[model samples]
Target: MSPTSASEIISALLDLTAWTVFDVDPEGRILAGNDESGSMQLVEIAPDGTRTQLTALPSRCSGRYVPGTRRVVVQHDNGGDEQMQLSLLDIEPSAPPADLPAGLPADLPTGRAARLPATLVDLTPLVHDPAYKHDLADVSAESVVFLTNRRDGVDFDVVVHDLATGAETPLYDGGGYLVDAVASHDRRSVAITTLSSRPRSTQILVAGGEIATSPTTGTTGGHGTTSETPEPHTGTARPVAVTAADEHAHHIHVAWAAGDHALVMSSDHEREFAAVVRVRSGDGVPASAETDGTVWETLVAADDHDLEVVLSPDGSAMVVGHHQDGVTTLAVHEHDGTHRCDVTLPDDGVPTVIWAPDSSRFAVHLTASGDPGSIHLVDAATGGVSTLVDGRAQIPEGLPISLPTVHRVPTPDGEQIPCFVYRPAGTARTGDENDHAPYSTTGNAAGTTVAGASVVLVHGGPEGEANRLFSPVIQALAGAGFTVLVPNVRGSAGYGKRWVSLDDVDKRLDSVADLAALRAWLPELGLDADRSALWGGSYGGYMVLAGTTMQPDLWAAGVDIVGMSSLVTFLENTSEYRRAAREREYGSLEHDRDFLVTASPITYLDQLRAPLFVIHGANDPRVPLSEAEQIAAALADRGIRHELRVYHDEGHGLAKRANRKDAYPAAVEFLTEILGR
Candidate 1:
């Protein structure tokens, strides 16, 4: 960032309001940190021209033990901007000298904001594995779940664990593709969907008391089948009532209706809300069909991602959530059309509708008249709203962590593109506190902050939309002190049709520009735009490469995690499902090769001036290891400085503890050395 005057260069540093940023030693001791973000420092110079602070940075003083081989790996982006980082020797712990009076204020994280137990910052660093798995992802009901081997050859039953206790229990032991699973109310039962390679019937498994005990499997993970009936349960199974019938009646609800009937909320997988179905539990035999049991849909144009039907315990009214571009909302329904009024969240956040067991008040997320984000519980009758929990709890202690700033940037077509940017905690625009709404402060923010450099974090799914999920990497980087920006660029979902379709086909390159604009705009907000770096995984991995390659002069370094380095290789190696579906975004390779090739980042590799690091998994079925091999081969052949980190046992993204243990350290060293901190 430049100084007060645009022309002159400033130190590109700021004093933080919360815990300071630190770089520590291998023995869990403070090395160096800025005074603003963390505690005061006690300086001690080491032989290797090193400076160690008595009080460690937030990343260093994590109050956790680190084994000799493992180090708390904190990655700073350096923003990968053009300029070199400031002097690292000057950084040390921010604590006051020991001679100072003990009467001074005591500052530390103690209450609910306390750090996770038994975990250190340097525990697992990011590695540039070229073959890391990105597809084997699971959203667990508990913060921590049991390990489920997600490889192709290894056929193993998946066991979902209890959130409080790590007691593992069987959910499904399928060999075929098991995309997702949700446990029932009693926690004893669960609903899982399995599909064969041929897109056959997506069988839903209800492991009530019946399917939990017996497990004699013969087939491999590439394919498996649910017994026509579930085996009896060994012990008492928790009774969980699932109402969601996945699209196409694949695997909807696993309820205990009519003795052992599972109620599923299903629809056609064509991304439409045509037919919603209810099936018997355990066996997927359809018990009934809604929409008047008619073949044709009343709302053909309705935008339905998945069936949002919440069936009442009495089986009378089912609250169905539907979206029709003009009107996206939830309504109470039965065999007839909607029975009650429709309820919509603010900007339609795909509301998570939780009905009381009695079905009186439908607790959901909603937008208040003048509030940025407010949670409300509505009376099912009058539709009157009452605020239950306001996320705006005054943070009397910590840093000023802001929510995502939603801006509608102007595109070439004069259309407004809604972009979400989350600034680091304790960092914000210089204005009245109340003028700016409390930022959602979602996703992940690293622990510490770099003095000058910031990272432009990218979200995967080129078609994926950003949400308020707990992100470890983002939090780690923020703890290490790097400003992060996650943009919901074109091709991302959740938006209307036009917004999502923006990155389809020839218009794909626009994502790169939208990102570059983010890079340029950061400097205007007191961040070091020129010193920023680029990092992301999956399609985000692709973006990291595109960021450095297309804007070669912009980033000082690039970190690609399970990203598509070469579209051609990715397209050639990916699964048939992905190859067919990805065409909507990149265009069908068989039909429009030229148009798809134009959006491929490999088309402009020669433009990559920044040092690049690419990581991937060997068993990635979606984007094969060949994508990394091609890019690595090209970079090596071109004599361009690069690093390739590969994980043989994983696919898409890293899952194994051993893989992350090695990978995260590599990322820290690379970012630190390149970022010059």
Candidate 2:
């Protein structure tokens, strides 16, 4: 079946769940509405017609209601957090006409309710509920807008949504998935970061007139031109100044937009800086002056950072959030592109930045020194920070600052890998965290100079890599007195595409070797080369299995999280949206069967000698729970010492605070017991 015409298109198009099905009579009144989709989680309407809401809803009595249509059209799928509308259903006249609204347009579709398309509801046994397949790290629906990003290579998009009709259209067309995309003040245009395929190269694309299209779903409205290639309205898409420095400008970020200007910021991946760019119909204009750079170089290389800019709605003020060395920096800059005030931070792992509409305040996902992760709000002028989401102490008790020592370990190759390794300053054998430290019979892991126990961290995405996100999980282990090392390895993103694609098929084992090289480097840093453990979740989890099996004698224990115990199971159950991408990323499940089998960690179950902890989210539609079962059953058959923790309600990554809490301490104990101080 054609990809576009695949019977699943409707649900795929409507996947977000927040959509509307309705008909607008030629008279401009909504004659009827199908049960609101997507918005089910957002609004609760009492049987009596009263409504309670999770997000702001659009006014039903308001503007932009298309004149009339019997033909139902899906208009927006991006408005999950706010009120939205889909399209008009062509309702048949039941009786004599009432006086129509004088402002209603006369060009509405004929008066007839159309039958639902047979292909609308996908009846296939294999179908993804009309929701995003890629993990949406964040979702926003306000002012009829939705923006999202994935751990995958897909570029981020900011969609204009009409929840009333479940229609969403992209605001613009090109660039790598952006970390942030937003609209400008007038709502006449939008300013956003361009996540380009190049990863390092980014551009600012100001949309011309609506292109006669839905900015979210890209469905054409009469305002859009007939051209396939989008062009600026009047050759006005000006290339404004993006950055003053050119040190691998990978994480270009747009904090916010307002007026006709945008507050744009960029970093060297370690320092924060900005520019005030004026937006034209299709391009941007740059304001003069540049702030002295602030600290950047977050967890991994500057290239691994997600974004650095956040601006006020009117693009008047902004902040540049970045990290340098092991510290994160938050810099507040004046909108006219003048001077900036900076604050340096440590323990706040890597941060995700969001801004208040006026740019007077901002927020970040914090990874403070204590180990629990958190989300905090900050005053741009005062530079004061307050926590919104506190760190949790295991799932049972919640606190955000207690998160992990999530960090990026710079490898000898100049590449940075995600690593979580640290022991309390002088905890000796044990502390409040855990006992014996993970993988520390005597000393730290291979990379850091610290004398703590060492834990080698692996990221889940063989296509993904580790970075500086807060992890109470890592902190608990460190508090227990162990060191962790997370390697971006081969398949991680934030880097160029080639770096990510390097691990596919024939080169699968190279990552295993990369870990080995890292292992050999631990001694150089004065960390214990002997005291080390391998652990990870998802692809990272798979790394635990692969790394341990590839070099059984190299470490002490292994921890896997929703990892593929067997590549066979992974290939069979992997979500369809991810199927083609994985095949292209790794190897064909059918054609390259042998290579896949060889790469399967389950295939080498018998060689596994260390105690292992396997964790899985039972509802994980991507890597099904069966993967853990197969590996555990195999381990059981062989009488291996391995424990499995299953979270029934969670999906791919741990969502509930409780799940994260449980998973962390359990992982610590398992690793420490096997590694032995």
Candidate 3:
């Protein structure tokens, strides 16, 4: 048996198509996004497995079908800037010519030809500013609600656009990053979540009644109105406080429940993990319900694991996605907190649940280390699962697909760091089995080999988790005969809230130290200790650079993709709307500039001994391209061994297949040359 070439492995992996179902209508039609056309595009999947491509553009797109209509509200951006904008795409068929001139054949082209070609109607043309971003929140039969910073390019205000009248109304004006908002069943109320300066802490607010009027013209104006007398009222609406200001906790995945109730997955009431809680609509804040006269009911307890919930369209049942260790388990429950049945997925991987309008069955997008990604229809009643879309159909036989083994590395403290280890094909177990006890691997367990080289792949977010999801880069590295270790460091999520905030602000370097810990423990897993490299993107990229500099001797090489070299510069050059939210995690430049400077990877550039490969997106709005340029420049001036590649057509990460095919294989080749296969 011979090892697969890097290009061949990447090409086969990149060719794999993963379908993510966005919206499912009552008629069993699914609106999904798949990269079948080289970039992610919206497609409509009929009940009979018929797929109709609805969008074809240079950039990737995601959208949901407008409820009770043939229209779809598409969210897309220029290049990969992340400043998303909304557009209207009507899928309804155009009427044939009433009287064909001297045409003998009356039957026009049927099927796809009978339908009008999809064309995007730009909804934000009045405020088409790339500096600001507009994110779709919720869509009703007659209106679309979105969060945008077009007003000041800082605070995100929830704006409601009338579908028929085109009149716009500013529904809410909470002074924070309005991350999510969902409309009630009646469309008279909206529940929103706002992030404060604290990490993972979000405040939930409910704005009810017709408090604001619609504007007739300007940025707030609709595309065109049919009403003779349009109502005047287009500004920001004040919201009633649901969560108190001082009671800080992580609240997310807000959904409208039965009646005026709202379901939120929150870590409130002194809980370490988030649980689904039902908040009864009222005038007072629900956080102080025990002391005050409000009602806060815990529908689903966290039970030692963080949970995410998605309510059915009809509000009869909900799916709770439980996160334990690195894998996920989804369970269904009744609206009244009754445990219905646990959804059985194809494999133990991460699943994103999207409910059908009829609530009969829901679609689950499952992805694991071995499985690329596939959409399955799970019977809500029986928990039986069936494949709806096979994402791995294009993967050629004999392709090396690595399934990760879960292991825990002990820190200097009493904490155990979780990591996913992937070894190359045909590797044999060499170490004593009891050396690292209690480690489990998904699918068929493969023997671990004493590899000469390994790659430590870090996940971004610092607040993010490294799960058992399929990663093309990891597979490529493993195919190239390198052991891959993906560690969920101290600051990573999926653990409790305390674990996520361990490296906040001044303590940011503690996460960098975690790399050192992982490297020291690598030999126990039958991996070479001195030949480990670091690779990550965004914050993970930051980790790569930080490990190479702060812990200079720990890594042999480093690959930083859109990572921040200097936290000070990152905070200074980041988008205005992102600064405050990021400040809560990293220190603020206003007060903690010196500390941020000390924690930056660039601050220790003189100590860096590892060769570096830098990749960045020119249009990245989160971590600006300057972050990449500065580090690359510093390395060049010092005559260090390094290379930088900037993609003009991308943002934070590679979205197009062409760029990924070029970049990732090149990265593998670079690492192989440096690490020695």
Best by TM-score: 3
**Which lDDT tens digits does candidate 3 get at residues 235-333?**
455666777655657777777665445554545546888888877545532333233545677888866888888877667888988888788999999
Residue 383 in model 1: shift from native, Å? Answer: 15
Per-residue lDDT tens digits for candidate 1, residues 1-677, read 21221001001111211122222222323322223223232232232434333323222121111112212222221111111111111122244455665666666433311332212231222221222211211222231111233333234244543223435455555444444444333333445554422221244544444322232110111011122334444643432323223333233322222222344354443443323554442343222223223222332124444444555433445567663321236666643345666554444433444443344555554322112233455556555666543423312233333345555555554555455555655454565443333323232233232545667777788767665432445544444445666667776655544466577567778877777777766654466667778888898989888888778878888788888876766777786535644554566678878866766778888886787778887767767778888888888888888899987766667644445546754664576567644
Q: lDDT scores for all predictions? A: 0.47, 0.48, 0.76
Output the better candidate (2/3) by lDDT: 3
lDDT ranking, high to low: 3, 2, 1
**Which prediction has the highest lDDT against the true structure?**
3
Task: For model 3, give the 10-residue run with minimal summed lDDT.
Answer: 217-226
Candidate 3 TM-score to native: 0.91
Which residues of candidate 1, in runs, are more than 4 Å off? 1-412, 415-419, 425-429, 432-449
Itemize residue pairs with steric clashes in candidate 3. 166-222, 213-233
What's the TM-score of each model vs. the native? 0.50, 0.57, 0.91
Once superposed on the true structure, which residue ranges of model 2 sit more than 4 Å away at CA?
A: 1-143, 147-159, 162-181, 188-307, 335-337, 344-349, 371-420, 428-453, 462-470, 481-508, 521-531, 566-572, 580-598, 657-664
